[model samples]
Target chain A: MFHNDGFHALDRQECLRLLAKVPVGRVVYTRQALPAVLPVNFSLDTDSSVLLRTPASSDLVRAIDGAVVAFEADDFDAVARSGWSVVVTGRATVVTDPAEHERLSRTGPRSWVVTGEGVFVRIESEMVTGREITVPHSTD
Target chain B: MFHNDGFHALDRQECLRLLAKVPVGRVVYTRQALPAVLPVNFSLDTDSSVLLRTPASSDLVRAIDGAVVAFEADDFDAVARSGWSVVVTGRATVVTDPAEHERLSRTGPRSWVVTGEGVFVRIESEMVTGREITVPHSTD
Candidate 1:
């Protein structure tokens, strides 16, 4: 029953549920002086952050390492007439620990970039927010 | 028709085409010794560049005002069992001209963030790359 003008605060369970449903999302960060947004494949971390895979040679790796970032995911079906979106904003860390990397790498995405490519970055969200879109039910 | 190890060099037209079909993507930036990635709605400009509307108050705006950035878009269809992705690396500029903003704003998108939100940020690409997921296609 969320309205357009009012933000429906999301609880932990709702946030997790939304994240599980959407596979692709946007990651926003600053490169030089303007905002840059990129499409990424991510898995939800056990701690509730977004885990993304990238190549070491990737510009995304270079530009976003050790920076503040935002990660979002959503789904819409015009025919079904329903959709939802979730956003996770926080600081990102490059996972260098072999054991941790190995664990994440097992479940992380295979870079759509290239073969022998690897997931070099990981982001842990500090704050999460979400909302949904639905046709207003008519009482008539 | 291009492949390098794993990276695919996608021309401008290919990037624009794929970008148009996808609705969610991520933005990456660096701030305070960490990397940040956020999801956002975006469009391909007439110049075939990536443009995003964001809140002026957002940290994304503060990071990209005069910085280097990168953008990405991708499409995935489980039914067709096919997908393609485009990545743009470049510098970002905030569009201030009313006419330009208004014109670009007309394209399709329903930003979850507030309007009067912030100025629009556009990325002027220097390098673009793309790839298609093919079960039979091998990089080796």
Candidate 2:
């Protein structure tokens, strides 16, 4: 569950539900005390990890050098005055085993960057948190 | 004009048009020699800059502080065997100035992450590149 200051908290199921709606997300990493975030298309692997596809020379490839990373995806609805978001802090790694890549192939995005050296990345969630907002009067 | 290694390259106008159709994209940032990318909903500003709304304390906010960032959005058409993608690489800064924030507010996403310290992070594109792929007939 996610709670901040005084707001509604969301559970794991709710978090995954909202995440399933969006195909793309941002992966956060640090470089020389500087921060950079790049967006990528991903799927939720059976192990409940986030899988992404990209080409070589991508900053994503450069930074993943075997380390835990941060991944996030979100959307909101102003008309309903309500929305939900989820964050997954996990360890990101290149899926080197061909079988794992083949398994990920089932649900990932249909297209690649069209650039060679394409590869897939996976993040195993260490901590998942989420939040929801509701503005009752605004809906009317 | 973005053509590399024998593929169709998309220009600035085409990039904007394509980005308008998708609600998700990845935001990649670097922290201490590591790279990260997250998904976000963004709208194209008048000058074709990337504008996204995020709450305070987001991994994005903390990680993307005054750094070079890459913002990417794409649309894929499977049946047609064609798809296009646009990538904007530039420096990102917090839009703290009230007036600029106001202007961006008009062009920003309809839903805002209702977390504390939500500020607009605008990426001013220094370089924009795009590509498209049309698969050959496999019936042969």
Candidate 3:
């Protein structure tokens, strides 16, 4: 009953669940007053926060630190014509604590862009929302 | 030779060609002065513009018209650990011309979210860039 214009809105719990399953997603941040989406691998923390690892000297580290950002993940089938999308809006803060870093290293997302100094950025979820559309079943 | 931190930057022509291959992507627009990425089905136009068909009554239709937004499309293999992402920054304008819509229909990306007023929103590409990371060749 949550359908709207063929896409149904998902609740907070479902959104988090779906997000936790996806390994790769895009992060949107403000770049010179315009938005830019950067694809990255992320891990969902126990507290519902998002952990992202990137190069210490990369643009992702430079653009967002203690700044508001958004992350999105989705899965869909082209032929079957179905999918779900979960988006999280939060603030990203660079983790500087060594103990926290070590703890996060054991549980946080591993960096995909290798061969650079790895840095961890944690996004504290402020709002989460999702939508899904599924293909209709055909009766035999 | 273009590799930096294990990722290679794609040129402009390569970025556009790659963008045309994807049918589904996310569009980032300003919602309440914050960035929001909405998954969308889009077509790459002849002039390098991005075309998206959403419900006329939808938020994408409402928030993007004449507004600067971002569009991202990518493909990655989680197991093989390789992928590329191309992001385009542009301005979205609702297509009011029926003739243009008809022409676009012949070659443009088809609408996915059904059951609403189909409004054509074309994002004029102002800048485009992409990066790809390839899996390392294994030598046994």
Question: What does DockQ come to for candidate 3?
Answer: 0.49
RMSD of 3: 3.3
- By lDDT, the best candidate is 3
- Quantify all predictions' global Cα lDDT against the true fold: 0.66, 0.66, 0.82
Q: Compare candidates 1 and 2 on lDDT and give the better one.
A: 2
Better of 1 and 3 by DockQ: 3
Query: What does candidate 2's lDDT look like per residue over B1-140, in tens digits?
Result: 22332237778778778887777676766645445455566787878788887765556777786878888776654355556767888888888899887776665664334444367888887878777764452331
lDDT of 2 by residue, A2-89 (tens): 1332237678878888888886666666645444454455778766788887654455577865777777777755344455667787
lDDT of 3 by residue, A9-126 (tens): 8899999999988889888999888888888888998899988987677777788998899989999876666899998999999999999888887878877655444878998889
lDDT by residue (tens digit), candidate 1, A26-135? 77777566556666667787777788876666777777788878777767553443466677787778888888888876776555444564655766768777765544
TM-score-better candidate, 2 vs 3: 3
Model 3 interface CAPRI class? acceptable
Candidate 3 chain B weakest ten by summed lDDT: B131-140
**Cα lDDT for residue B108, candidate 1:** 28
- For model 3, state the Cα shift of residue B76 in Å: 0.7
Model 1 chain A poorest ten-residue lDDT run: A1-10
lDDT of 3 at A50: 88
Interface RMSD for each of the candidates: 7.0, 6.4, 4.9
Fold similarity of candidate 1's chain A to the true chain A, as a TM-score: 0.84
